[model samples]
Target: MNGGGSCSLGSVLCVITGASRGLGKSLAWELCSRVMPGSTLLLVARTEKALQVLAEELTLKYPGITATWVAADLGTGDGVRRTVQAAHEMNGQDTAQRVIIVNNAGSLGDINKYFVDFTDPQEVDKYFSFNVSSALCLTSSLLKVFQGRPGLQRLVVNVTSLAALQPFKSWTLYCAGKAAREMMFRVLAEEEKDLRVLSYSPGPLDNDMQEEVRTHTKDPDIRQQFLIMKESGKLIDCHVSARKMLDVIQADTYNSGDHVDFYD
Candidate 1:
Protein backbone atom coordinates (compact mmCIF):
# COMPACT_ATOMS: atom_id res chain seq x y z
CA MET A 1 0.00 0.00 0.00
CA ASN A 2 1.12 3.54 -0.68
CA GLY A 3 1.79 5.20 2.66
CA GLY A 4 2.85 8.72 1.85
CA GLY A 5 0.08 11.31 1.61
CA SER A 6 1.71 12.61 -1.53
CA CYS A 7 1.40 9.25 -3.25
CA SER A 8 -0.98 10.83 -5.75
CA LEU A 9 1.43 13.64 -6.49
CA GLY A 10 4.32 13.78 -9.00
CA SER A 11 2.78 11.36 -11.52
CA VAL A 12 -0.87 10.59 -10.78
CA LEU A 13 -4.03 12.36 -11.89
CA CYS A 14 -7.54 11.03 -11.30
CA VAL A 15 -10.62 12.20 -13.15
CA ILE A 16 -14.01 11.43 -11.58
CA THR A 17 -17.19 11.89 -13.58
CA GLY A 18 -20.67 12.56 -12.12
CA ALA A 19 -19.12 13.49 -8.81
CA SER A 20 -21.98 15.61 -7.48
CA ARG A 21 -23.72 13.09 -5.24
CA GLY A 22 -24.29 9.49 -4.17
CA LEU A 23 -21.72 6.92 -5.26
CA GLY A 24 -19.80 9.46 -7.31
CA LYS A 25 -19.39 11.80 -4.36
CA SER A 26 -18.36 9.01 -2.04
CA LEU A 27 -15.88 7.67 -4.55
CA ALA A 28 -14.34 11.10 -4.97
CA TRP A 29 -13.87 11.49 -1.23
CA GLU A 30 -12.39 8.02 -0.80
CA LEU A 31 -10.00 8.50 -3.67
CA CYS A 32 -8.86 11.77 -2.20
CA SER A 33 -7.92 10.03 1.04
CA ARG A 34 -6.43 6.81 -0.29
CA VAL A 35 -4.92 6.31 -3.73
CA MET A 36 -4.33 9.87 -4.88
CA PRO A 37 -3.99 11.84 -1.68
CA GLY A 38 -1.95 14.69 -3.18
CA SER A 39 -2.83 14.17 -6.82
CA THR A 40 -4.95 16.44 -8.93
CA LEU A 41 -8.61 15.41 -9.04
CA LEU A 42 -10.77 16.68 -11.87
CA LEU A 43 -14.36 16.44 -10.67
CA VAL A 44 -17.01 16.50 -13.40
CA ALA A 45 -20.64 17.03 -12.53
CA ARG A 46 -23.62 19.02 -13.75
CA THR A 47 -24.41 20.34 -10.30
CA GLU A 48 -22.27 23.37 -9.66
CA LYS A 49 -23.20 23.71 -6.01
CA ALA A 50 -22.38 20.10 -5.17
CA LEU A 51 -19.08 20.24 -7.03
CA GLN A 52 -18.13 23.51 -5.41
CA VAL A 53 -18.91 22.12 -1.97
CA LEU A 54 -16.83 19.00 -2.57
CA ALA A 55 -13.95 20.95 -4.03
CA GLU A 56 -13.93 23.35 -1.11
CA GLU A 57 -14.09 20.56 1.44
CA LEU A 58 -11.23 18.67 -0.16
CA THR A 59 -9.12 21.78 -0.44
CA LEU A 60 -9.57 22.60 3.23
CA LYS A 61 -9.30 19.04 4.50
CA TYR A 62 -6.30 17.98 2.42
CA PRO A 63 -4.03 20.92 2.03
CA GLY A 64 -1.57 19.25 -0.36
CA ILE A 65 -4.22 17.79 -2.68
CA THR A 66 -5.58 19.71 -5.63
CA ALA A 67 -9.29 19.43 -6.35
CA THR A 68 -10.69 21.15 -9.41
CA TRP A 69 -14.32 21.24 -10.50
CA VAL A 70 -15.77 21.28 -13.98
CA ALA A 71 -19.49 21.88 -13.87
CA ALA A 72 -20.43 20.63 -17.32
CA ASP A 73 -23.06 18.31 -18.76
CA LEU A 74 -20.90 15.33 -19.70
CA GLY A 75 -23.51 13.74 -21.95
CA THR A 76 -22.63 15.77 -25.01
CA GLY A 77 -19.75 15.88 -27.48
CA ASP A 78 -18.81 19.36 -26.41
CA GLY A 79 -18.97 18.37 -22.76
CA VAL A 80 -16.73 15.36 -23.24
CA ARG A 81 -14.25 17.35 -25.27
CA ARG A 82 -14.16 20.11 -22.71
CA THR A 83 -13.67 17.62 -19.86
CA VAL A 84 -10.73 15.97 -21.63
CA GLN A 85 -9.20 19.36 -22.34
CA ALA A 86 -9.60 20.37 -18.73
CA ALA A 87 -7.87 17.21 -17.57
CA HIS A 88 -5.05 17.75 -20.04
CA GLU A 89 -4.59 21.28 -18.85
CA MET A 90 -4.46 20.16 -15.22
CA ASN A 91 -1.90 17.47 -16.07
CA GLY A 92 0.25 20.12 -17.72
CA GLN A 93 -0.54 18.98 -21.25
CA ASP A 94 1.10 15.56 -21.25
CA THR A 95 3.44 15.76 -18.23
CA ALA A 96 1.47 13.56 -15.79
CA GLN A 97 2.48 9.92 -15.80
CA ARG A 98 -0.55 8.11 -14.45
CA VAL A 99 -4.15 9.02 -15.29
CA ILE A 100 -6.96 7.25 -13.47
CA ILE A 101 -10.28 7.76 -15.21
CA VAL A 102 -13.41 6.96 -13.23
CA ASN A 103 -16.44 6.95 -15.47
CA ASN A 104 -18.98 6.93 -12.64
CA ALA A 105 -21.68 9.25 -13.96
CA GLY A 106 -24.92 7.61 -15.13
CA SER A 107 -28.71 7.84 -15.17
CA LEU A 108 -31.83 5.65 -15.03
CA GLY A 109 -35.06 6.12 -16.93
CA ASP A 110 -38.58 4.65 -17.45
CA ILE A 111 -38.96 4.07 -21.15
CA ASN A 112 -41.43 1.21 -20.95
CA LYS A 113 -44.43 3.44 -20.27
CA TYR A 114 -43.90 5.49 -23.39
CA PHE A 115 -41.43 4.58 -26.10
CA VAL A 116 -41.33 8.20 -27.24
CA ASP A 117 -41.09 9.97 -23.89
CA PHE A 118 -39.78 13.35 -24.87
CA THR A 119 -40.67 15.53 -21.93
CA ASP A 120 -36.93 16.10 -22.06
CA PRO A 121 -35.38 14.38 -25.00
CA GLN A 122 -32.39 16.55 -24.34
CA GLU A 123 -32.11 15.15 -20.84
CA VAL A 124 -32.48 11.63 -22.17
CA ASP A 125 -29.85 12.39 -24.76
CA LYS A 126 -27.65 13.71 -21.97
CA TYR A 127 -28.13 10.41 -20.19
CA PHE A 128 -26.79 8.41 -23.10
CA SER A 129 -24.10 10.98 -23.69
CA PHE A 130 -22.77 10.80 -20.14
CA ASN A 131 -23.45 7.11 -19.55
CA VAL A 132 -22.02 5.63 -22.73
CA SER A 133 -20.60 8.09 -25.22
CA SER A 134 -18.67 10.31 -22.83
CA ALA A 135 -16.96 7.34 -21.24
CA LEU A 136 -15.70 6.15 -24.58
CA CYS A 137 -14.73 9.60 -25.74
CA LEU A 138 -12.81 10.39 -22.56
CA THR A 139 -11.03 7.04 -22.53
CA SER A 140 -10.08 7.45 -26.17
CA SER A 141 -8.75 10.90 -25.55
CA LEU A 142 -6.71 9.71 -22.55
CA LEU A 143 -5.31 6.77 -24.48
CA LYS A 144 -4.06 9.25 -27.04
CA VAL A 145 -2.43 11.27 -24.29
CA PHE A 146 -0.78 8.18 -22.82
CA GLN A 147 0.30 6.65 -26.12
CA GLY A 148 4.03 7.11 -25.71
CA ARG A 149 4.22 6.74 -21.94
CA PRO A 150 4.84 2.98 -21.88
CA GLY A 151 5.52 2.65 -18.15
CA LEU A 152 2.47 4.62 -17.03
CA GLN A 153 -0.34 2.67 -15.42
CA ARG A 154 -3.27 4.16 -17.27
CA LEU A 155 -6.57 2.93 -15.78
CA VAL A 156 -10.22 3.43 -16.69
CA VAL A 157 -12.94 2.33 -14.31
CA ASN A 158 -16.49 2.16 -15.69
CA VAL A 159 -19.17 2.32 -12.99
CA THR A 160 -22.11 0.12 -13.93
CA SER A 161 -25.18 -1.16 -12.10
CA LEU A 162 -26.73 -4.57 -11.38
CA ALA A 163 -29.56 -3.48 -13.67
CA ALA A 164 -27.19 -4.30 -16.52
CA LEU A 165 -27.06 -7.90 -15.33
CA GLN A 166 -30.85 -8.38 -15.13
CA PRO A 167 -33.67 -6.89 -17.14
CA PHE A 168 -36.25 -4.86 -15.23
CA LYS A 169 -39.74 -4.03 -16.51
CA SER A 170 -39.70 -0.24 -16.38
CA TRP A 171 -35.96 0.42 -16.66
CA THR A 172 -35.62 -0.65 -20.27
CA LEU A 173 -33.58 2.28 -21.46
CA TYR A 174 -31.31 2.23 -18.42
CA CYS A 175 -30.61 -1.45 -18.80
CA ALA A 176 -29.83 -1.06 -22.47
CA GLY A 177 -27.59 1.95 -21.90
CA LYS A 178 -25.68 0.31 -19.04
CA ALA A 179 -25.25 -2.88 -20.99
CA ALA A 180 -23.90 -0.92 -23.91
CA ARG A 181 -21.53 0.98 -21.67
CA GLU A 182 -20.23 -2.22 -20.09
CA MET A 183 -19.71 -3.84 -23.45
CA MET A 184 -17.90 -0.77 -24.68
CA PHE A 185 -15.43 -1.00 -21.79
CA ARG A 186 -14.94 -4.71 -22.40
CA VAL A 187 -14.16 -4.10 -26.04
CA LEU A 188 -11.83 -1.26 -25.17
CA ALA A 189 -10.00 -3.48 -22.72
CA GLU A 190 -9.51 -6.04 -25.42
CA GLU A 191 -8.38 -3.47 -27.94
CA GLU A 192 -5.97 -1.72 -25.59
CA LYS A 193 -4.10 -4.54 -23.90
CA ASP A 194 -1.78 -2.23 -22.02
CA LEU A 195 -4.44 0.10 -20.66
CA ARG A 196 -6.34 -1.27 -17.69
CA VAL A 197 -10.10 -1.06 -18.23
CA LEU A 198 -12.68 -2.45 -15.81
CA SER A 199 -16.46 -2.75 -16.02
CA TYR A 200 -17.84 -2.86 -12.48
CA SER A 201 -21.43 -3.13 -11.19
CA PRO A 202 -21.71 -1.68 -7.70
CA GLY A 203 -25.04 -3.52 -7.07
CA PRO A 204 -28.20 -1.93 -5.63
CA LEU A 205 -27.72 1.07 -3.36
CA ASP A 206 -29.92 2.89 -0.86
CA ASN A 207 -29.66 6.06 -2.86
CA ASP A 208 -32.10 8.37 -4.53
CA MET A 209 -32.34 6.07 -7.51
CA GLN A 210 -33.50 3.19 -5.35
CA GLU A 211 -35.91 5.48 -3.52
CA GLU A 212 -37.26 6.48 -6.89
CA VAL A 213 -37.67 2.84 -7.75
CA ARG A 214 -39.49 2.10 -4.52
CA THR A 215 -41.79 5.09 -4.90
CA HIS A 216 -42.54 4.80 -8.59
CA THR A 217 -43.14 1.10 -9.02
CA LYS A 218 -46.72 0.36 -9.97
CA ASP A 219 -46.65 -3.16 -8.50
CA PRO A 220 -47.05 -3.17 -4.76
CA ASP A 221 -45.44 -6.57 -4.36
CA ILE A 222 -42.38 -5.51 -6.30
CA ARG A 223 -42.05 -2.38 -4.24
CA GLN A 224 -42.41 -4.44 -1.07
CA GLN A 225 -39.64 -6.73 -2.22
CA PHE A 226 -37.34 -3.75 -2.61
CA LEU A 227 -38.37 -2.41 0.76
CA ILE A 228 -37.65 -5.76 2.33
CA MET A 229 -34.23 -5.79 0.74
CA LYS A 230 -33.56 -2.31 2.00
CA GLU A 231 -34.82 -3.09 5.50
CA SER A 232 -32.75 -6.26 5.61
CA GLY A 233 -29.60 -4.23 4.96
CA LYS A 234 -29.05 -6.13 1.76
CA LEU A 235 -28.85 -2.87 -0.14
CA ILE A 236 -25.29 -1.46 -0.24
CA ASP A 237 -24.54 2.13 0.64
CA CYS A 238 -22.75 4.49 -1.73
CA HIS A 239 -19.67 4.72 0.50
CA VAL A 240 -19.22 0.98 0.74
CA SER A 241 -19.53 0.60 -2.99
CA ALA A 242 -17.08 3.44 -3.54
CA ARG A 243 -14.56 1.83 -1.20
CA LYS A 244 -14.90 -1.50 -2.97
CA MET A 245 -14.27 0.18 -6.31
CA LEU A 246 -11.11 1.80 -4.93
CA ASP A 247 -9.95 -1.60 -3.72
CA VAL A 248 -10.59 -3.13 -7.14
CA ILE A 249 -8.71 -0.34 -8.83
CA GLN A 250 -5.73 -0.65 -6.50
CA ALA A 251 -5.65 -4.45 -6.52
CA ASP A 252 -5.99 -4.59 -10.28
CA THR A 253 -7.49 -8.05 -9.77
CA TYR A 254 -10.38 -7.78 -12.20
CA ASN A 255 -10.06 -9.07 -15.72
CA SER A 256 -9.98 -6.14 -18.07
CA GLY A 257 -12.49 -7.74 -20.44
CA ASP A 258 -14.93 -8.97 -17.78
CA HIS A 259 -17.85 -7.41 -15.93
CA VAL A 260 -17.29 -7.51 -12.15
CA ASP A 261 -20.43 -7.46 -10.00
CA PHE A 262 -20.67 -6.38 -6.40
CA TYR A 263 -23.09 -9.20 -5.65
CA ASP A 264 -20.39 -11.64 -6.58
Candidate 2:
Protein backbone atom coordinates (compact mmCIF):
# COMPACT_ATOMS: atom_id res chain seq x y z
CA MET A 1 0.00 0.00 0.00
CA ASN A 2 2.59 2.51 -1.01
CA GLY A 3 -0.11 4.69 -2.50
CA GLY A 4 -1.58 5.57 0.89
CA GLY A 5 -4.84 3.79 0.05
CA SER A 6 -5.47 0.12 0.71
CA CYS A 7 -5.34 -2.33 -2.22
CA SER A 8 -9.06 -2.88 -2.34
CA LEU A 9 -11.00 -3.87 -5.44
CA GLY A 10 -12.31 -0.36 -5.93
CA SER A 11 -8.84 1.12 -6.18
CA VAL A 12 -7.66 -1.30 -8.85
CA LEU A 13 -7.92 -0.60 -12.55
CA CYS A 14 -7.78 -3.77 -14.64
CA VAL A 15 -6.78 -3.83 -18.29
CA ILE A 16 -7.37 -7.17 -19.99
CA THR A 17 -6.66 -8.06 -23.61
CA GLY A 18 -8.08 -10.89 -25.76
CA ALA A 19 -11.18 -10.63 -23.67
CA SER A 20 -13.75 -11.61 -26.28
CA ARG A 21 -13.92 -15.32 -25.50
CA GLY A 22 -12.20 -18.31 -23.87
CA LEU A 23 -10.03 -17.73 -20.81
CA GLY A 24 -10.07 -13.99 -21.45
CA LYS A 25 -13.84 -13.95 -21.12
CA SER A 26 -13.69 -16.10 -18.01
CA LEU A 27 -11.09 -13.87 -16.38
CA ALA A 28 -13.27 -10.83 -17.11
CA TRP A 29 -16.14 -12.43 -15.27
CA GLU A 30 -13.97 -13.38 -12.33
CA LEU A 31 -12.65 -9.85 -11.99
CA CYS A 32 -16.14 -8.45 -12.29
CA SER A 33 -17.27 -10.59 -9.39
CA ARG A 34 -14.32 -9.69 -7.21
CA VAL A 35 -13.65 -6.00 -7.92
CA MET A 36 -15.10 -3.63 -5.38
CA PRO A 37 -17.43 -0.74 -6.03
CA GLY A 38 -15.99 2.01 -8.25
CA SER A 39 -13.53 -0.36 -9.92
CA THR A 40 -13.08 0.05 -13.67
CA LEU A 41 -12.29 -2.62 -16.26
CA LEU A 42 -10.87 -2.04 -19.72
CA LEU A 43 -11.23 -4.99 -22.10
CA VAL A 44 -9.49 -5.22 -25.48
CA ALA A 45 -10.39 -7.58 -28.32
CA ARG A 46 -10.89 -7.68 -32.09
CA THR A 47 -14.62 -8.31 -32.20
CA GLU A 48 -16.68 -5.18 -31.73
CA LYS A 49 -19.87 -7.13 -31.32
CA ALA A 50 -18.44 -9.43 -28.68
CA LEU A 51 -16.95 -6.54 -26.73
CA GLN A 52 -20.27 -4.70 -26.81
CA VAL A 53 -22.07 -7.84 -25.69
CA LEU A 54 -19.69 -8.27 -22.77
CA ALA A 55 -19.94 -4.59 -21.85
CA GLU A 56 -23.72 -4.85 -21.76
CA GLU A 57 -23.64 -8.08 -19.76
CA LEU A 58 -21.22 -6.72 -17.18
CA THR A 59 -23.28 -3.59 -16.77
CA LEU A 60 -26.32 -5.70 -16.04
CA LYS A 61 -24.51 -8.13 -13.77
CA TYR A 62 -22.74 -5.54 -11.67
CA PRO A 63 -24.65 -2.29 -11.84
CA GLY A 64 -22.04 -0.30 -9.97
CA ILE A 65 -18.95 -1.53 -11.79
CA THR A 66 -17.40 0.53 -14.58
CA ALA A 67 -16.43 -1.49 -17.63
CA THR A 68 -15.25 -0.36 -21.06
CA TRP A 69 -13.92 -2.18 -24.11
CA VAL A 70 -11.79 -1.46 -27.17
CA ALA A 71 -12.63 -3.36 -30.32
CA ALA A 72 -9.26 -3.38 -32.07
CA ASP A 73 -6.78 -5.94 -33.31
CA LEU A 74 -3.86 -6.50 -30.99
CA GLY A 75 -1.82 -7.94 -33.84
CA THR A 76 -1.40 -4.61 -35.57
CA GLY A 77 0.35 -1.38 -34.57
CA ASP A 78 -2.64 0.87 -35.19
CA GLY A 79 -4.89 -1.41 -33.21
CA VAL A 80 -2.40 -1.38 -30.38
CA ARG A 81 -2.41 2.42 -30.42
CA ARG A 82 -6.18 2.56 -30.31
CA THR A 83 -6.28 0.11 -27.41
CA VAL A 84 -3.75 2.09 -25.37
CA GLN A 85 -5.52 5.34 -26.12
CA ALA A 86 -8.82 3.94 -24.99
CA ALA A 87 -7.33 2.61 -21.79
CA HIS A 88 -5.59 5.84 -20.99
CA GLU A 89 -8.76 7.81 -21.59
CA MET A 90 -10.82 5.48 -19.42
CA ASN A 91 -8.16 5.26 -16.74
CA GLY A 92 -8.11 8.83 -15.50
CA GLN A 93 -4.76 10.30 -14.46
CA ASP A 94 -6.03 11.80 -11.23
CA THR A 95 -7.15 8.47 -9.85
CA ALA A 96 -4.69 6.78 -7.54
CA GLN A 97 -5.85 3.29 -8.44
CA ARG A 98 -3.17 0.67 -8.86
CA VAL A 99 -2.92 -0.40 -12.49
CA ILE A 100 -3.27 -4.07 -13.45
CA ILE A 101 -2.45 -5.03 -17.02
CA VAL A 102 -3.14 -8.60 -18.09
CA ASN A 103 -1.64 -9.43 -21.47
CA ASN A 104 -3.83 -12.43 -22.26
CA ALA A 105 -4.43 -12.16 -26.02
CA GLY A 106 -2.41 -14.60 -28.16
CA SER A 107 -2.65 -16.82 -31.19
CA LEU A 108 -1.46 -20.36 -32.00
CA GLY A 109 0.18 -19.52 -35.28
CA ASP A 110 0.38 -21.85 -38.33
CA ILE A 111 0.48 -25.35 -36.93
CA ASN A 112 0.32 -27.18 -40.27
CA LYS A 113 3.91 -26.49 -41.39
CA TYR A 114 7.28 -27.16 -39.82
CA PHE A 115 9.00 -23.98 -38.56
CA VAL A 116 12.13 -24.58 -40.64
CA ASP A 117 10.20 -25.51 -43.78
CA PHE A 118 7.67 -22.70 -43.35
CA THR A 119 8.81 -20.08 -45.79
CA ASP A 120 6.03 -17.53 -45.54
CA PRO A 121 7.82 -14.59 -43.92
CA GLN A 122 4.53 -12.75 -43.56
CA GLU A 123 3.06 -15.58 -41.56
CA VAL A 124 6.09 -15.72 -39.31
CA ASP A 125 5.89 -12.00 -38.65
CA LYS A 126 2.19 -12.29 -37.87
CA TYR A 127 2.75 -15.00 -35.28
CA PHE A 128 5.34 -12.86 -33.52
CA SER A 129 3.09 -9.79 -33.72
CA PHE A 130 0.15 -11.51 -32.12
CA ASN A 131 2.01 -13.35 -29.40
CA VAL A 132 4.91 -11.09 -28.53
CA SER A 133 4.98 -7.64 -30.17
CA SER A 134 1.43 -6.74 -29.21
CA ALA A 135 2.00 -7.55 -25.55
CA LEU A 136 5.17 -5.49 -25.55
CA CYS A 137 3.49 -2.47 -27.12
CA LEU A 138 0.55 -2.53 -24.75
CA THR A 139 2.71 -2.95 -21.66
CA SER A 140 5.00 -0.15 -22.69
CA SER A 141 2.07 2.13 -23.41
CA LEU A 142 0.60 1.62 -19.96
CA LEU A 143 3.91 2.21 -18.28
CA LYS A 144 3.62 5.79 -19.43
CA VAL A 145 0.70 6.29 -17.07
CA PHE A 146 2.82 5.40 -14.07
CA GLN A 147 5.85 7.48 -14.90
CA GLY A 148 5.49 9.96 -12.03
CA ARG A 149 3.10 8.01 -9.86
CA PRO A 150 5.47 6.00 -7.75
CA GLY A 151 2.94 5.65 -4.98
CA LEU A 152 0.68 3.52 -7.15
CA GLN A 153 1.51 -0.15 -7.58
CA ARG A 154 1.95 -1.36 -11.14
CA LEU A 155 1.31 -5.05 -11.79
CA VAL A 156 1.57 -6.81 -15.14
CA VAL A 157 0.45 -10.41 -15.67
CA ASN A 158 1.53 -11.88 -19.00
CA VAL A 159 -0.40 -15.07 -19.76
CA THR A 160 2.13 -17.58 -21.00
CA SER A 161 2.13 -21.30 -21.93
CA LEU A 162 4.17 -24.47 -21.29
CA ALA A 163 5.51 -24.14 -24.81
CA ALA A 164 7.66 -21.25 -23.61
CA LEU A 165 9.73 -23.61 -21.49
CA GLN A 166 9.77 -26.60 -23.86
CA PRO A 167 10.08 -27.13 -27.60
CA PHE A 168 7.55 -28.84 -29.84
CA LYS A 169 7.58 -29.78 -33.51
CA SER A 170 5.66 -27.32 -35.72
CA TRP A 171 5.31 -25.06 -32.70
CA THR A 172 8.47 -23.07 -33.21
CA LEU A 173 6.77 -19.71 -33.74
CA TYR A 174 4.43 -20.10 -30.78
CA CYS A 175 7.16 -21.34 -28.46
CA ALA A 176 9.65 -18.65 -29.41
CA GLY A 177 7.08 -15.85 -29.05
CA LYS A 178 6.07 -17.02 -25.58
CA ALA A 179 9.68 -17.25 -24.50
CA ALA A 180 10.34 -13.74 -25.82
CA ARG A 181 7.40 -12.31 -23.87
CA GLU A 182 8.53 -13.95 -20.64
CA MET A 183 12.07 -12.73 -21.07
CA MET A 184 10.87 -9.21 -21.84
CA PHE A 185 8.94 -9.13 -18.59
CA ARG A 186 11.89 -10.54 -16.72
CA VAL A 187 13.95 -7.62 -17.95
CA LEU A 188 11.18 -5.13 -17.21
CA ALA A 189 10.90 -6.41 -13.63
CA GLU A 190 14.61 -5.97 -13.09
CA GLU A 191 14.55 -2.42 -14.52
CA GLU A 192 11.54 -1.13 -12.60
CA LYS A 193 11.65 -0.77 -8.87
CA ASP A 194 7.96 -0.04 -8.26
CA LEU A 195 6.55 -2.51 -10.77
CA ARG A 196 5.61 -6.17 -10.29
CA VAL A 197 5.59 -8.32 -13.40
CA LEU A 198 4.57 -11.94 -13.67
CA SER A 199 5.00 -14.32 -16.57
CA TYR A 200 2.26 -16.83 -15.77
CA SER A 201 1.66 -20.06 -17.63
CA PRO A 202 -1.96 -21.13 -17.33
CA GLY A 203 -1.16 -24.74 -18.28
CA PRO A 204 -3.40 -26.84 -20.55
CA LEU A 205 -6.90 -25.45 -20.42
CA ASP A 206 -10.11 -26.47 -22.13
CA ASN A 207 -10.17 -23.44 -24.36
CA ASP A 208 -10.48 -22.66 -28.05
CA MET A 209 -6.69 -22.55 -28.35
CA GLN A 210 -6.40 -26.10 -27.06
CA GLU A 211 -9.14 -27.21 -29.44
CA GLU A 212 -7.11 -25.67 -32.24
CA VAL A 213 -4.10 -27.65 -31.11
CA ARG A 214 -6.14 -30.81 -31.29
CA THR A 215 -7.64 -30.21 -34.72
CA HIS A 216 -5.26 -27.94 -36.61
CA THR A 217 -2.03 -29.85 -36.14
CA LYS A 218 -0.44 -31.74 -39.01
CA ASP A 219 1.46 -33.98 -36.63
CA PRO A 220 -0.57 -36.96 -35.47
CA ASP A 221 1.31 -37.21 -32.18
CA ILE A 222 0.71 -33.57 -31.33
CA ARG A 223 -2.98 -33.93 -32.17
CA GLN A 224 -3.24 -37.14 -30.20
CA GLN A 225 -1.52 -35.60 -27.16
CA PHE A 226 -4.13 -32.86 -26.91
CA LEU A 227 -6.81 -35.42 -27.74
CA ILE A 228 -5.70 -37.57 -24.83
CA MET A 229 -5.83 -34.61 -22.50
CA LYS A 230 -9.36 -33.90 -23.67
CA GLU A 231 -10.57 -37.49 -23.61
CA SER A 232 -9.01 -38.19 -20.22
CA GLY A 233 -10.92 -35.19 -18.75
CA LYS A 234 -7.62 -33.58 -17.84
CA LEU A 235 -8.20 -30.33 -19.68
CA ILE A 236 -9.13 -27.68 -17.13
CA ASP A 237 -12.15 -25.49 -17.71
CA CYS A 238 -11.31 -21.87 -18.53
CA HIS A 239 -13.17 -20.53 -15.52
CA VAL A 240 -11.42 -22.90 -13.13
CA SER A 241 -8.05 -22.14 -14.68
CA ALA A 242 -8.76 -18.43 -14.38
CA ARG A 243 -9.65 -18.73 -10.71
CA LYS A 244 -6.40 -20.54 -9.97
CA MET A 245 -4.46 -17.87 -11.83
CA LEU A 246 -6.18 -15.19 -9.79
CA ASP A 247 -5.12 -17.01 -6.67
CA VAL A 248 -1.50 -16.68 -7.75
CA ILE A 249 -1.95 -12.99 -8.52
CA GLN A 250 -3.59 -12.36 -5.18
CA ALA A 251 -1.08 -14.42 -3.22
CA ASP A 252 1.79 -12.53 -4.87
CA THR A 253 4.38 -14.94 -3.50
CA TYR A 254 6.87 -14.80 -6.35
CA ASN A 255 9.31 -11.97 -6.73
CA SER A 256 8.69 -9.19 -9.27
CA GLY A 257 10.59 -10.82 -12.13
CA ASP A 258 9.60 -14.45 -11.51
CA HIS A 259 7.91 -16.87 -13.90
CA VAL A 260 5.15 -19.07 -12.46
CA ASP A 261 3.04 -21.90 -13.86
CA PHE A 262 -0.48 -22.60 -12.70
CA TYR A 263 0.58 -25.99 -11.43
CA ASP A 264 3.48 -24.44 -9.55
Candidate 1: deviation at residue 232, Å?
Answer: 2.4
TM-score against native, each model? 0.86, 0.93
> Can you give the lDDT of residue 222 in candidate 2?
84
Model 2 Cα lDDT, one tens digit per residue, 1-264: 111123234466888999999889999888777666677888899998998899889989988678899999888999999987897787664464567899999988888778677788897888888788889888998888545474677799999889888988878888899889999999999898688898888889887898899998877888899899999999988887787777776777789978788788
Best by lDDT: 2
Q: Listing every candidate in turn, what is its Cα RMSD in Å to the true structure after a full C-alpha superposition?
A: 3.3, 3.4
Rate residue 216 of model 1 by lDDT: 76
Off by over 4 Å in 1: 1-11, 93-97, 111-127, 146-148, 218-221
Compute the lDDT for candidate 1: 0.76
Q: Any residue pairs clashing in model 1, and if so which?
A: 75-130
Top TM-score model = 2
